[model samples]
Target: MIDYKPVSTPMSPKPKLSLTSGTLFDDPSKYRMVLGSLQYLSFTRPDIAYAVNKMSQFMHRPTDMHWQDAKQILRYLARTLSHGIYLRPNAPLALHAYSDADWTGDSDDMVSTNAYLIYLGSAPVSWSSKKQRGVACSSTEAEYRAVANTTAELRWLTSLLTELGVRLPTSPVVYCDNVGATYLCANLVFHSRMKHIALDYHFIREQVQSGELRVEHVSTKD
Candidate 1:
């Protein structure tokens, strides 16, 4: 792809890749090799992280469509070679995060995709984009699961920073786009819809009650 035309985006928003969408790729090894390199690239180029994660799901049995998507990522890289995360030494030391979910996004399994980006002051220190373990019954459930995942990561980061002698001035806040999920965090009344995910509910509620974490609602447009 050295001389390929550049693309503005890594993956096309229209295509929803599935496990069995296209014919088998002619060269499986090549597909895996290229995707493996892209996985490494995602560490610095978070713009391509979701695309890489989506393509990586098909590594075991790559199709022609998957190969084309991978090439598109390369094209995107060519267009934005200079883009990367910049860390500022004078950035604040507080921790805050944003969590989101695409409910029933997977074409094959109907599992939701949960992602979170945690920022330590100005620079992003931790982020994740992956499918949920189980199918969520509602959009609220999916969003709550994402918030739970983000809270767990924040707890770990808090412990690690504490060990490093770094102190945060305030409790970390998790910003979620779904208002219902945010309410679930602080509301003790358990709705019947959320009973299936009781474990996750209690786990996050414990942190909030102890003043270790805070969950807030943020509009998706923000």
Candidate 2:
């Protein structure tokens, strides 16, 4: 839609899509081709990452509704033709990340979406937006899982930087929006409540106790 009217957002806020809601698209091949291009575009255009990820879930059986959503992303791209990630020269060597979860975001599977964005100084270096492996029992559990995911990414990035002879001035910090999840990262008293995710609990707790990472809560408004 080169001349189509541009949209302010990539995906609609209401009427979340489902797996079996709409009639199957007649042009499945074309849908996959456009989606493939969008997937490549997402590497440099994080603004469309979440929308692209959501559309990808229906790649195997894209419906007309999914195609329309995909086109919405294209319309958004039209409005943001000049937007892209810019890594400033001599940016700080420090790393910080923001992690969040949309609890039970998937109406079909009841699975939460875990997302994290890692910044090396002012530029985003790594990011992910994917559904959790299993349904979360609570919003705190979803948020905690997101933190654990972010922590894993930080660990790898730290090791990579160390090998490259780059030492950060301070330990990496993880900003999460959930108070319960942030508290769970530093306190063992919440262990009993999170026994189901014992591995993630211990992994993040280890980093927090040893001062390798800090998990702090921030207001969602921020």
Candidate 3:
């Protein structure tokens, strides 16, 4: 236990839903059925994510440790039964995103994680927090990749809104904390330093130049 410290969280209190796990592996007519329900609960409770992911790794074996984790998760739910995200239906719609990367923050693989979220009047309608698929030689490269992913999500959400008759302005603003990446998206200028990034990542540049998307810079959170 000393080798693995529990990750600390700074979350405040909130209301959540209650759920029950069926049983242990014995007399398990509905073990898989129960697992399906448990899987969906991950949508709201990020607290048990690490434990659930770890328990899933040993599904074929059904080890004592896995069942222990399941019961412990139930106990945790008993205590934290009132915590969740909430959004009201009457709020106005506003689509905007903030994109960023960790800049080689991963100790395991040295690949920085890309994080972004798009909001509709303060509620997060779309969000992603993922490690880059490939190594980036510079912070600029990682940031550019993050912005590309964010741009894709923005386009998809915009199209969905249009179909739903939720009218949006001409250009959606995507904020990036990297100036170099912002410039790259708005230009075809061949800087000797950034020639190594994939050509496909440059696709956002056309979108930027055409006034379909706008990239602005912001200061990173400390």
Instruction: Give each model's whole-structure lDDT.
Output: 0.90, 0.93, 0.68
lDDT of 1 by residue, 111-212 (tens): 999898999998888888899998999999999999988999999999999999999999999999998999888888855557888574568988988998
Q: What are the root-mean-square deviations of the candidates from the true structure over C-alphas? A: 1.3, 1.0, 8.5
Candidate 2: the clashing residue pairs are none
- TM-scores for every predicted model: 0.95, 0.97, 0.65
Q: Top model by TM-score, which number? A: 2
CA error at residue 196 for candidate 1, angstroms: 0.6
> Residues 19-95, candidate 3, lDDT per residue (tens digit)?
22323456233444444566678666545544454345345545343454555555566656687656878766767
For candidate 1, what is the TM-score?
A: 0.95
Model 1 lDDT at residue 12: 92
- Model 2 lDDT tens row, 1-222: 999999999999777899996999999999999989999998888778888889999999999999999999999999999898899998998999999999999999999998999999999999988899999999999999999999999999999999999999999999999999999999999888988985844799999999999999999999
Lowest-sum lDDT 10-residue window in model 3: 10-19
Per model, state how many residue pairs clash. Answer: 0, 0, 5
Give me the overall lDDT of model 1. Answer: 0.90
Give the Å shift of residue 172 in candidate 3: 2.1
Predict model 3's lDDT versus the native: 0.68
